[model samples]
Target: MASAKPKFPAIKPGGSLILAWQVKGKHVVVVGGGEVAAGRIVHCLNADAVVTVVCPTSGLNPEVAFRVSEGQVKHTDRNFEQSDLDDADMVLVAIDDPAASTAIWKLCKERRIPANIADVPPECDFYFGSVHRDGPLQIMVSTNGKGPRLAASIRKFIAKQLPSNAGNAINSIGNLRVKLRSIAPDPAESRKRMAWMTKVSDTFSWEEMCKLTDEDMDFLLRYYPENKAPSFSELRIAQGAPDPQGVDPFDGSFGFSVGA
Candidate 1:
């Protein structure tokens, strides 16, 4: 017997546009209580948004209950209400009830609020992309509502390539920039000095960069370009290896009919 083939779509996602919303001190509302809703609530909390979950109380997931207990989220023990969306920066409707979810979507549209509905891409005003966050560095990946699991797998790959001390390494380099500005205020000369800073920073391991004191950073800024590259005794030290983990790139093994 021959295997069935896949159908390809001629059209693709429109394009990629990226923006970071400043959610700190803002309110975010989620209208569901299951795993999907709980996941969105956690993301809002991470962004420092005051989160409120509005749904029937009896079906709340364990994660939601835990977040409420920890004071990270507020739970309103009732169905979603339009008034709940007041002052909201964003809304997520994860419930399966199409009529209710549609009502929420219309309300958000009227209020000009960005909204996302789990498992229902056509109704979404935006998507929750896979996010890789390191202290001040954030990478967001989106497959344009096509393959969220694939997006998540790619995010894990990119995030793992960064050194563990990346945050501190960036701070060390930043301080050097400030010092250069103080010493060489002239624009053209400062550009050349900035190039040297970039080159010297690229030569060291992020761990070694983090270990450098302000004195070491100053030394590098002073003698770099004139001096040869720093020795790798500290820079090249192998801090042992990390445990390997299997990576799954595919979304699923479950069988579903395309012509159903």
Candidate 2:
């Protein structure tokens, strides 16, 4: 007899799927103007998308609009209709009305437009994740649309640990890469140079580097190779007092001694 096959629960008609879409230079339509909409807009802008906002009652905050309005996003203060989806490559429906949001979702599906429903995951084609940005580096976190708040909290924690000068360090490394490539044209030599550079970067304290001038950086890069890099751990040990175990102290505890 053939073995019986186990049946699994089927996916509902509408279910959330987390996906990463390359939206660079693409048109994204946002249909709301509240804080939620603002957050989505910021993410879209950071991804270099051309955004168009449609709000029947309100528009994006003036400050946000000013910062990103260099023809990247245009606002239309009117209720959304099927016609609005004509030129939109991607759409985000964050409106308060569930019926309207559902309507837009159906239209997007019919028109073959990718869409995300901000508050309703089942009605969304894709979902946006929490993001952290440091210069050229960007980190995105997703919870599979299960717990967005948790994702945001994790992003906040990571943001705290990331150095503020991380962007500058990345830019410096890029410039160094160009210079290193010129000197070490061979792939093997270039790999070795990059390894040495990484070691130097790891050894150098970003805080200390922030105080140094461009000439100081250049001098260190030229004078100190990885093998000759200064030892920060040694400096720290030198600054600290000798361990009590190494000293011939009467006892471990110390108190004020009276000249009795």
Candidate 3:
């Protein structure tokens, strides 16, 4: 029998490998001056890249143009040049002319430089994601260049649902780990302690624990009946809770600061 036709494309274009780049002290070339280019330029600047705009027009953004005037960026109001890609670790081409943009993309590929072409998915190496940052915590949503609007809508939804205390909660939990290591320097002892702490975490929320002062913390550890985690049955009773069927009593998702 003849081989059945392949049911689908061997590889889909939508699969993305996400990563964060260290752009500090790196050269980033932006090759357009339109509003889109302006946004791209700002992103590069925020990442601490040494940015240069190579759009030969008044279309270059005011903020970037102003920065160029102040000697922050190199601006060549001219056509794309091979030299523009020199020393550029990342390139973004935002020009209106397809031929020019394509040429720039080809050159970037030849030099193995990372690149993005505004609104032209096929010609681009990567698509930007809608990102929300809280200190070191970040939530990024992407559409794999399929529907940026949908990705943005999802990001808005996520932003609304994210807890305001997320950063503080993470910090408190991290500090507890440091304390655990100091208290149990032996590897096996640390693991045993960590297992106990993990059980405690299942019962107590960071918010409740964080409310305790340093003195309270010391008292709880040093004087509070052997630093023992409460038995699950005891926890269930103390929580005014129902039967757990010998599993977690809660039917919903919980965080580090749960039950308390």
The residue ranges of model 1 lying beyond 4 angstroms of the native Cα positions read 1-13, 174-213, 221-260
Model 3, 34-153: lDDT tens per residue?
A: 778777877777678888889765766777677778877778888779998889999998878888888888999999999998878887788888877665567779887778889989
Predictions: Cα RMSD each = 15.7, 11.7, 8.5
lDDT of 2 at 59: 59
Separate clash counts for every candidate:
0, 0, 2
**Please, what is the TM-score per model?**
0.68, 0.61, 0.64
Better of 1 and 2 by TM-score: 1
Candidate 2, residues 73-97, lDDT tens digits: the string is 6887688978889999999987789
Instruction: Write down the TM-score for model 3.
Output: 0.64
Q: What is the lDDT of residue 174 in candidate 3?
A: 64
The TM-score that candidate 2 achieves is: 0.61
lDDT of 2: 0.69
Pairing residues by index, what is the TM-score of model 1?
0.68
- How accurate locally, in lDDT, is each candidate? 0.74, 0.69, 0.70
Please tell me which predicted candidate would have the highest TM-score against the true structure. Answer: 1
Off by over 4 Å in 3: 1-14, 66-77, 171-260
